[model samples]
Target: MAARALKLKPPPARLWISEWPRGAINAARLAGARRRLREVPRGDGRPVLVLPGLFNSDRSNFALRGYLNRLGYRAFPWVLGRNLGARTIGVEGERLFARIAAVAAETGAPVTLIGVSLGGIMARLAAHRRPDLVREVITVSSPFAGDPRATNVWRAFEWLTGERIDDPRVAALREEIARPLPVPATAIWSASDGLVNGRACRIGGERAIEVVSSHVGVQLNPDVLVVIAKVLNGQNADHD
Candidate 1:
């Protein structure tokens, strides 16, 4: 990585505080855009698993799952409870892989994964370990690439997961997950994100869609929903 990239920093403190109000506004935007959101092309009934961000529960992704279901895709939440990092999934993410495999087995087809924030990182790991069971991956506001510290939540992540971000083991896992995924992947990021640096969310070699939104709002943003719908339908979001 270049020296400049290595020096990447988290979003400013002001932006961090703005996330709350911005998230509320984005939610309102989503509500107002519902009619148009429903206009996105439908899917082919492929199963999609939606994973929530750190400290968030499946209930947080309820809106997203409902939207996907309305579009003809079978979307389910990561039912193992609120995301507690390694505590929720296994240290090696064995439990997450098991969930993905179960979904694939139930659907009789490789499953598509849509993960938000830390959930996205876990999704990529699962895809890396078992691409055979994963059809594709879509990440929203997830800092899978670049320094994980380039996010305001790094401290919270460390506190909750009970692991140092600078630990060599964590660094190794980040490098592994940051690599290009074996399955098709798309990254949805926001330059206005308050929780994580947008640059870190999108890797150079993968498909990326940019939206203007707060980090907490990306998963619920109507624009994000549209891009995700396009990707799942196999339509080009190259214009983004």
Candidate 2:
């Protein structure tokens, strides 16, 4: 059978307008952290490593890491400073590989990788290159299944990474990054996302899940958090 072609259209302009309100609501999530904590299942203290999106640093995932910690998981930040795309993935992804190995060694078990947006793409790549160190992979709002230009942030990504969207190297890397992960993987996407086309985020298969959230708010969206908790606790038998 022939491979399916990717449809690459940017999301409607109106969707972008919802971002502001959604972000504001997500910011308010901190106020209910204690309450939200009771709603999700706890983990077995397995290590979880979180990666931030482009232009973001470990600080961007503070809330997420904190939440995971409260759930009895040993969550850690990437500690790689701001995400700058190709630079961090260079040397055949040695930097990321080393980090995963370190985390696995520290936990005495493979680590679960939870990435947000661009970070999700990196997580998938890490899992592909070193499945032995990865327990599972979960991506939020990552457009790994479609053309790189299928998102509103493509230009910003180019600006931050210093790589042209059409550059051969960038294209090749995207193709490699889009390959199916060797470890179990889940793609959590939001239909109301403004930065990227939601359709482009689907990984195609039983592992794809859809929620209602904004691109910037997905990290804090209550529904998204619940899903993450479920996946981490190995309670999502439907997807697995």
lDDT of 1 by residue, 77-155 (tens): 8898989988999989999999988998998999999999999999998998999999999999999887878898888
* Candidate 1 pairs with clashing backbones: none
Pick out the ten consecutive residues of candidate 2 with the lowest summed lDDT: 1-10
User: How much lDDT does each candidate structure score?
Assistant: 0.88, 0.82
Which regions of candidate 1 fall more than 4 Å away from where they truly are? 1-6, 238-240
Q: What lDDT score is found at residue 110 in candidate 2?
A: 97
Per-residue error (Å), model 1, residue 51: 0.8
Off by over 4 Å in 2: 1-5, 237-240
**What's the C-alpha lDDT at position 96 in model 2?**
87
lDDT of 2: 0.82
Model 1 residue 92 CA deviation (Å) reads: 0.5
Per-model clash counts, in order, read 0, 0
**After best superposition, candidate 2 residue 119: deviation in angstroms?**
0.1
